[model samples]
Target chain A: MTPKMNSVGVIGLGSMGYGVATSCIAAGLETYGSDIRPEVCARLIAEGAADASTSPAAFAGRLDAVILLVVSAAQCEEALFGEDGLAPKLRPGVPVVISATIAPADSRRLGARLAGMGLPMLDAPVSGGSIKAGKGQLTVMAAGAPETFDAVAPLLDAMAEKVYRTGTQIGDGAMVKTVHQLLAGVHIAVAAEAMALAARAGIPLELMYDVVTHSAGNSWMFADRMQHVLDGDYTPRSAVDIFVKDLGLVNATGDSLSFPLPLARKAYELFAKASEQGFGKLDDSAVIMNYVGSELPGTRDN
Target chain B: MTPKMNSVGVIGLGSMGYGVATSCIAAGLETYGSDIRPEVCARLIAEGAADASTSPAAFAGRLDAVILLVVSAAQCEEALFGEDGLAPKLRPGVPVVISATIAPADSRRLGARLAGMGLPMLDAPVSGGSIKAGKGQLTVMAAGAPETFDAVAPLLDAMAEKVYRTGTQIGDGAMVKTVHQLLAGVHIAVAAEAMALAARAGIPLELMYDVVTHSAGNSWMFADRMQHVLDGDYTPRSAVDIFVKDLGLVNATGDSLSFPLPLARKAYELFAKASEQGFGKLDDSAVIMNYVGSELPGTRDN
Candidate 1:
């Protein structure tokens, strides 16, 4: 079905946001892009995105739907409902799709504020990483009022392979997303630990990677990120800082809700220590090296 | 090529052993089968396996090759080099393949013992679980003498998708399998902790599973086993004791090697706690419900 919602605004043009904006245009949405960085905004405009104001409010009155691709719950609140927010600029019944992975309480509060402003807010958090975002194959966890889902359906389809209607409550999407982060973080940590242990035991890291990939020990994290270890390239596809944000959201929600998450908490501690080791800007997989310490089985030659 | 090595003896007629024995027979070998249980031997005999003595030695002298599929390293050692053992009974050169997942040092010791008897021993551990075993699509990690590889080629073809040759040393396969266990155990633990957090936080477990399975949080473990959680049926396909054994292997190797293995140790602790809590025979997925006394979500209805 053709998307009835035409004008699309994707805020926060970071790696994920840029990929999403590219997908929006590729999917034939009349896409507008903005970010905190002027260079990024100019690049998006050069790539055929409409040169839009950084303010989420700029597309409000004209847009049938707006997608908040910003980082953190605070940014989402500010962009949608804080001073000079999009909620005040939108038509009475327009839809707002919040796509940041955030705490459930933040989603519920922001969604309630938008609803009070006569805006239909869909609490949507996306998955599948940046590559999938660029391909428009992202999975979205979303919950909203009935009309909100229908109103934003077009934009959701243009950008996602699946949209889970988790519950009627706004926080359900963010809650599920938090759960996703918990597993993702833990799996990455475990993959690093296993790889390091193997390497320390005198198994060549490259051979260990190959053997483990074919064995039962394999995980998506190992499959996707082990190459970085073999090559000794810690270049950031997903930065270590990303986990700092993700695990923070996890611990925050876990603490507030009293959820028992000791393993997840322990994994976050490792990632935090790795970040503190000055690997924060590198890829998250670099955390393996931190755990392994010196005397690494040298990386593959470039 | 058709196997020139005609007479092949397969010990241990359990799931994996039966599958390997069937594959050997299909490959045109004169296959003999033996297990502790007489009923299993009777079943193998009815299925075309030649009736064999409970003696690994009897088959050792008659057969070109012998495959040991016992449960533990001790059982493998007992079957191969016990006082009344196949190593002494073999005609000084018949190759023996050990296909049980075991400790590397144990495999090394067994290899040394076999060498003294002038018999070649291949430390060959397998993956792909029981169902894959039945289909002969298992992964085989093998290490031993070069001639041993030549002798085992026909039987290997009958039972594996891939054969990873670690090195010309018996402990190679066990070392690689230990690496596999580390990854597998951690993945299961991560899945358990994530799913439990979701349940405790009031997110629907089915929806949580679906979203995480499709997202970056996904691993082979989550995709394969979360359904049992959704179905609330924890029947032991791969029992809890399996992880207790596998993770213990991982930690044992890591500790002996002085490798820092926080995640591997944590994984073993979780499985050990679950086994202690009485889910010992349930599917390994039952480890997800092990945070019992902490009183977060308690246990799901399954």
Candidate 2:
């Protein structure tokens, strides 16, 4: 079936955004890419994006839908309503699908602001790292008005393998995503903790990894991230600071609700410490260094 | 080819133990059962065990191998060395495979004690819970001398679907199990923390569960234990104090090595608090009560 939205604009062409833009191109959508990095925009254009427009406003009016894949809610706001904001140039009723991991409250506020301008907003936060994003196999936890979801179904389909309609309330997607990040962040931290203890006890990290992946102890993060620990490669498929940021959002939401999330708080602290120790730019699995000190399993120091 | 060992003695017939005993019987072994509870011992006999002796000494000499599925290290030592102890009555070279979760140090100590009596021991802690145990599909993380493992191969094959030889060291299995518990315990607690946050935000617990199970946030424990949260069924499939004990073991190991496991420690505290608040006998998912208070998702209070 031909998708209704034939042309798409994807802002913030970082690792995730770049993948989304390329996937849209692969899905036969005329994709426009924007990023703070002009070189990345150029690279996306070379990779089959129809245009590498650094200014979203330049082609915003022609786009059928816009996807915001920036890092933070503030950036989501700035990109859409800032000095060179694209929302102002877009035609009314053009659905804006925000796939950034933002707070539900922020998402609700953004949806309200866009509604005031006659635009529809769907809070569609995504999971699965850039690898899946590049494969167009991301899982999108989305919530918005039914028509808004229908409007962006094709764009969502282009970038995601599974798109869950959380509810018609815009913030439901963000709330689910926040809870998801809570699990993802804690699982990574606990995987690191488990591995460090295994390493300290003189069990081979590879054997521990094999046993865990096959056992009830396994998690998607444990299977995926612990490989980096085994290989001693910290190339930052997802960096430490990302969880530091995401778990911080989790805690912020908990705080706003006067609810306590101790595990999330602890995981956030672990990531924050990893960031503080100069491992922030390293892979999230490098959080093991917080427990193992300088002697990582596959590293030269060991 | 027939297994090297044909007759087996299984001690402790609680949920996990009863399943293991039945699985051994199903494998065509002459399984003997021993439990403090006379009724459970009789029950195992009804399920085709060759004998159900309350006193291990009564059958220890005839068994080709013995499997201990008791609760703790002290109980393990008591079962083998206390009045009516089985070790003294067993023939030399009768491998004793201990499937109870215990500290590595305790396992090593038991290995030393058993070696003094010409008894070989395998530290073989199990996972997959009671259901898998009944299906004979549990994962066994075992460590012992190669000869000892070979001696009990048939019995291990009968009880476990996957048997990982962690190493030749007696304590290695315990270490791996401890590490596994570190992951499992933390995952359950974090699952509770995440679900609580979702419930607090008014997201349907069922939808959050579905989204997580399908996303990167998924873990074996979250998928298994959170169902209790959704059903509001606090039935003790695995109780809160089990993690209180397991994560306590995790932290004790951490303390011994001078390693810090902040996530495990936080999860342990959550479980301990749950236990303290009278949820200890409930399923481990009841840890969510620590976060959501009395208003659990499917409970009448909600």
Each prediction's DockQ? 0.66, 0.88
Best by lDDT: 2
Output per-candidate TM-scores for chain A, rounded to 2 decimals: 0.93, 0.96
Every candidate's fraction of true contacts kept comes to: 0.75, 0.96
Models, CA RMSD each: 2.9, 2.2
Give all TM-scores, in the order shown: 0.93, 0.96
* TM-score of model 1 vs. true structure: 0.93
**DockQ-derived CAPRI band for the predicted complex in model 1:** medium
lDDT of 2 at B106: 91
Q: Give residue A6's error in model 2 in angstroms.
A: 2.9
At residue B142, what lDDT does model 2 achieve?
Answer: 96
**Which stretches of model 2 miss by more than 4 angstroms?**
A1-4, B1-4
lDDT for model 2 comes to 0.90
Q: Tens-digit lDDT track for model 1 on B256-278?
A: 88777888788788899888988
